[model samples]
Every structure is written in structure tokens, then in C-alpha cells.
Target: MIVVDGHCDVLWRLWEDPERSFSDGTLQAGAERLAAGNVRAQVFALFVPPQVPRGQRLKAALAMVDRWHGEVVENAGFRPLLWRDDVPRVTGGDRPWALLALEGAEALEGELVHLRVLYHLGLRMVGLTWNEANEAADGCGEARGGGLTRFGRSLVEEINRLSLLLDVAHLSERGFWEAAEHYDGPLVASHANCRAVHDHPRNLTDDQLRAIAESGGVVGLTFVPAFLTGGEATRDDVRRHLEHAESVAGEDHVAFGSDFDGIDRVVAGLEHAACYAEWADYLLRYYPASSVEKWLAGNWLRVLAARLPARPMTNL
Candidate 1:
């Protein structure tokens, strides 16, 4: 089966530690491990740490983008997904495809021109905030729980105009609703769980899940143990979250996000990408082949096909 993971922080890891090899098994979603997991395509998030000086955030993002170009894109085992047509080329191939995504709007530094530049640089997805207030919007961790800022509204419009996938995984409740209300395109919570299963703030509530379903978007059921439960998470905990997500979002809207290198703890039996085949087997025991396929990659494929631009655009 071809798996499409919506989120991984391997690029941030590579940027933080230049000596690390993507093929090395030390990291959760290393290229070798992704191949073993049957992951045909993976979204690599360019996450700028909050501590980075404000003026240097864009530089950090560009550096990670360059790292992606040098390491994953130029490598024979992986291809950078520059357009929607690139999606099918990964299936049955010896290697996986990589898609670039921005985890936080800080990279834009409150500038829409930078957003356009990043889009042209092959960034196909954008998340407005990480876990705090930014020039664009309020994140899940914000105490005031505000909605999208004036600039954030414009950014959302620009994202729709550019046909980039809008992610709501870390948006505050108000911000999420604001996005749902304005953006008239396919949406995704790249790496998140169902709040109905676990009360973590990072998890989406049933209403939020249904909203995504209604928009013909997908919610990537994440592997973070803390998001799954207050205790150690097992395959069963993962299963519960998926089951509840499917119930609320519908089968077509639920897919695996597996926060991979971005997370500190993983589900007990699913510690790395290589374990996906085993995880799929466990899922098969409960769901039919069709449902399992949707959860694995089909749903994400549908979103990509529907939302990504038909051809690469020129800012000129």
C-alpha cells in the first residue's frame, strides 16, 4: 500500500544538525525508514523555532529550504513534489516524494510578498501559526484565543489564490473557525488527533473535524503519544483516535499525519516510519481494505489532486 504522511519535521532536524544523514535510521522519518514504511509521499515541514531572532526567521526558513533542495530534492531516492502531477510518480517507485510546507507564518515576517516567493520556491502548504500569536493569527497555545488578524485574512486569501494547502493543526479555536469561514478550498490539519478521544488542546474537536469533512478536506491522525492520551500511547490508543476521527470526519477525511521527527514521543508500537507496515496490519484487523486505503493515502491523494495548482505558476 502507498502511504502519504501529511507532516514530518525531518527538514528542521536536518537544519538543526547539518551532519545528520536523512538515510540514517536514527531519525524517525529518515528516507530509508520511509521507504521501508511504504510511504510514497511525505510532507516536510519547515519549522522556525520561536527563539530565533525575528529578523532571522526568514533566513532560517530559506536555509531549511536549501537543505531540502540539496539533500532530498537532489537525491535520487526522493523527488521534490513541485506540482500536482508529481504525486502519481511516487507510487510503485523505489523512492518517496517530498512536499514542502511551512509550519509557522513567522517565516513570512508579516509580508505577503515573501509568501508568494515561498510558493514559487515550491512550498505547497502553509500553516498560519505554530502555537502562539503571530502577525497572522493566534495559535492553539495562545491564551486570548483570538481569530485571524487583518494580515492573516489577507494571507488566507493569498493562499487560496495561490492554491496552496491551508493547514489548521495549530490554530486557536477562533482562528480555526475564522479559516473555515473564509477559505473556500480544501483544508487539512496536517498532524493532529481528535479531541473527542483525547482532551488535549492540540486535538480537534468533533465540530472542527466535521467542518473539515464538509469542506472535502482531510485530518491527519497524528502519532504524538501525549495528544493521544495522558499516559503512554499504544496501537490501541492510536486506533481509538482514528476510529473517533472517522466517525466525526467520515472515512474519507481521516489520514495519517505521523508528526515523526517533530514529536518527542510516539505510539508504543509505532516508534518510526519503518513500523507503518505493521501498523497497517493492525488497522486491517478492524477496517475493510477500502477504508484502510483511504486512511493510508487515498484521502490525502484526493485533496492534493483537487487543491494543488494544475501547473506551476509564475509570479511575474
Candidate 2:
């Protein structure tokens, strides 16, 4: 079966350490690791940290996008997926594929034009915030707990117009609902877990999970240790959150996000991208092969086919 990780920070990692190659073995998402993990397709997020001064945020995001094209997409074993039709090519072959995602709107700098440009540059997904407030909305880490702004609503409309994947992994609770109010079709919490299980701000509440399910969306069970346990996390923690998400959202909405290169600490049995193969084995003890197949790649494929634009978008 093919494995599709809904989220990772390899570009962010490569961007941070300029000398490192995308295939560098030291990196968690290095070429060797991804090959060993057998992760046939992966989502690489362009995450501009909140502290980046407003003036330079766009440049920072663009640089990562450049690396995505230069490094990840240019690699021999990887292919970039920019259309709904591209899904079959990746899953049907041995070569790994990639989808681009923005972890926060801070990179857009309050401009819808930039959103279009990013989409044109192969950005298939957009996450509104990354743990701090931006023009779009308050992130989960924001104490004020506000919802989407007028600009945020417009951003959602633009995302809809472009047929981009909407991610709510770090939005504040109120912000999540407000965005949901205006955005039709499915949404992906690309790298979030169940708050009902771990109680982290990054995790989605049962209501949020159900909302995703009701909309025919998918939720990636992240491997962030702090979100899983008070200390080091294990595959069992992943199982618990997966089971909880399945219970509330039903099986269709559940899948793996991994949050691999983005995080510092690691889950005990899941140390890097390659470990996904092992994690899949751990999951099999508790689930049937068919169900495990969906959690690994099939469910995410379902979302891609339904959410991606049928042809190259020209609405702008």
C-alpha cells in the first residue's frame, strides 16, 4: 500500500539550514528516509514562523517555495502533484509524489494576490495560522481566542475559488468555526490530533472532528510527542488518537499527517519519515488490512480527487 503523509516541514528544515540538501541523510525527511519509509507521497509545508517581521514574510515564504521547486520537485524519485488527475500517477507507481501546503497565512501578508501566486507556484493547501494571530485569524496559541477576520473570510472565499485544500491545524476554536461558516466543501486539519485525547491547542475538539467528517474531510493524526503524551510518545499514543478520531469522525475522515520534519522531539517508535512503515505495522495489530489501507493513503486520495481543481485554474 502507498503511504501519504498529509504534512511535514522538510522545506522549512531545508530553508533553515541552507547547506543541507533535500536528500541529506541527517534530515528526518531526507531522500533515503522517505524511500525506506515507503511514503509514496508527502505534503511539504512552507511554514513562515510568526516572529518573521511582517515586511520580510513574503520573501521567506517565496524562498521555501523556490526550494520546493529546486530541491524536492527536482529530485529524481519525487514528482509534484498540481492537479486532481496527478493522484493516480503517484499511487500507481513506485516513485514518491509531493503536494505543497502553506502552514500559515502570515506568508500571504494579507493579500489575496499572493495567495493566487502561491497556488500558481504549486501550493495545493493553505493553513490559516501557525500558533499566533495574523490578518486571517487568531491561531490556537492566541490567548484572545478570536475568530476569522473580514480578511480571513475573504481569504477563505479565495481558497474556495482556487480549489485549494483548507487546513485548520492551528486555528483558534472560534476562528475554526467562523472559517467553517463561510468555506464550503471539505477541509483538512493537515497535522492535528484529537483534543479529546491529548488536550493540546493543536488538536481538534470532537465537534471540530465531526464537522470535518460531516463535510467529507480528512484529519491527519500527528506525531507531535507533546500533543500525544506528557513525556515521550509511542505508537500506542498514535493508536489511541486514531481510534478516538475514528469514533467521532468515522473511519473515512482519519489518516496520517506525521508532522515529521517540523517537530523537534519524536515519538519513541516513530523517529523519522522512514519509521512510517513500522508505524503502519503497529497499526495493523488493531485494524483490518482494508481499514489500514485507507488510513495510509486511500482516504487522502479520496479528498484529493474531490477537492482539487478538475483542470488548471484560471479564475484569477
Candidate 3:
């Protein structure tokens, strides 16, 4: 299967410590597992925390992407994938493809011009907010639940103009609807779950799920325990979310978004990427193979190929 995860924090973690590659023993999963597990492409996000200095957020993000690129170039088994165009090449043989993404709009520093710079730097996928509000949009945790700001509107428009995919994973409810109602193309909740199942503000409400589906977007079911079951989330916990997401967003709009290396806690049986195959086995009982393919990776890829521009080599 050509698996494409919409989210992962390996890039930020690697930048924190380049000594530990995916092939290294420290992290849960790495480049080696991606190749071995038949993951065609994995989106490695440049997660910028709100606490980080505003001026330094973009720098930090770039540094993380650079670290991943260095690892891929130095390692024969790994391949760096900046655009959809490189997918064929990266997955042609046994190598695994790496796609760079931004976990928050903080990297843009509240300026649409900064977005252009980041896009030029090779960011194809962008999450409008993290757990806090910024110049771009409001996060789920924001007290006001504000929608896209003036600057955010410009950013979203520019993203659409440039054919860059917009993700509303951690956005506030207002911002989520704003993006859904305003954006003309496909949208994504790159790493989120159903609010009906978890009641957490971080999860998507039923209205948001339908909006995503109506907009022709997908919602990546997260692997965090709280989102899956709020207790000891096992393989069954993830299964419940998967089933619910399929029921709400339809089978084509559900996919795996293992916030690996970002969330401190993972579901009991889904601690790493290698366990995805096992997760697949568990899912097989409830869903058909075709439905499973879309959930595993196909849905996200289809959206990207349909809406976003191929990654330009100059940026990365």
C-alpha cells in the first residue's frame, strides 16, 4: 500500500537532535520503518510552538526541514520528496518518500508575504492554527473561538491562489467553518478526531466533519489516546474513531494521522508506524480493502493531487 500520513513530528524532533535519525534507536519510528512498512510517503511537519520567538519560528521550521533533507541525502535508503512530482521517483524502488509540512501558521509570522517565502521554501501543506491563535487564525483552545482574521483571510486566499493545501486540524470552531465556507478547493483536518466521540475541543464536531466532506476534504483520524477514547485507547479505540469518521465523513474522507513524536501518549497497540499494519488487520474486519486504502493514505493524496501544485524543486 502507498501510505501517506498527513502528519508527523519527526522533523521537529530531529532538528532538536540530529544525532537521532529514524534509523536510530531513540524515536518510535524512523526512515527504516517507513521503507519496511511500505509507506510510500509520510508528511513530516515543522511544528512551531507558540512559545518560540516569533522571528525564530520560520527559522526553526526551516532548520527542521533541512535536517530531514540532510538525513535523506546521507542515507541511501531514504529519499526526500518536495513535490507530488517526486512521488513516482521516491516510491519507484524500495526507498520511502518524505513530504515537508507546516504544523502551524506561526511559521508565516502573520504576514501573507511571509507565506510566499515559506511556500518558496517548499511548504505544500499548512495547518492554519495549532492550539493557540495567531495572525492567521484562532486555535481550538482559544477562548473566543474566533474565525480567520483579516491577515488570515489574505493568507488563505494566497494559499488557494498558489494551490497550496490548507489544513484546519487545530483551528477554532469559527476558523474551521471560515476555512470550509471560504476556501474554494479541498480542505483537510490533517490531524483530528470526532468531537462526538471525545468531547474534547481538539476533536471535530459533527458539523465540521460534514463541512469537510462537503468541501471535498478529508479528516485524518488522530492516534492520541484522548481523541480516540479518553481512557486507555487500544487498537479498538482507534477502530471506533475510524468507524465513526467513516460514518460521518464517509470512507473516502478518513485516513490515519499519527501525530507521532508530537503526542506523548499513543494508543496501546499503536505506539509506532510499524504497528499500522496491525491496525490495518483490525480495520479489515469492519471495512473493505478499498475503504481501508482510502483511510490509510489514498484520500489525502487524491486531495493534494487534485488541489495543490506539485512541489517545486527550488524551494527544498
Best by lDDT: 1
Spell out the clash pairs found in candidate 2. Answer: none
TM-score of 1: 0.97
Over 4 Å off, model 2: 313-316
lDDT of 2 at 261: 82
Residue-level lDDT of model 2, residues 98-155, one tens digit each, is: 8999999999999999999998899999999989999999999999999998899999
Residues 227-274, candidate 1, lDDT per residue (tens digit)? Answer: 989879999999999889988788999999999999887788899899
Q: Give the winner by lDDT: 1 or 3.
A: 1
Model 1 CA deviation exceeding 4 Å by range: 312-316
Worst 10 residues of 1 by lDDT: 307-316
What lDDT does the true structure give each of the candidates? 0.90, 0.89, 0.78
Give the CA lDDT, 0 to 100, for residue 71 in model 2: 80
TM-score to true structure, per model? 0.97, 0.97, 0.92
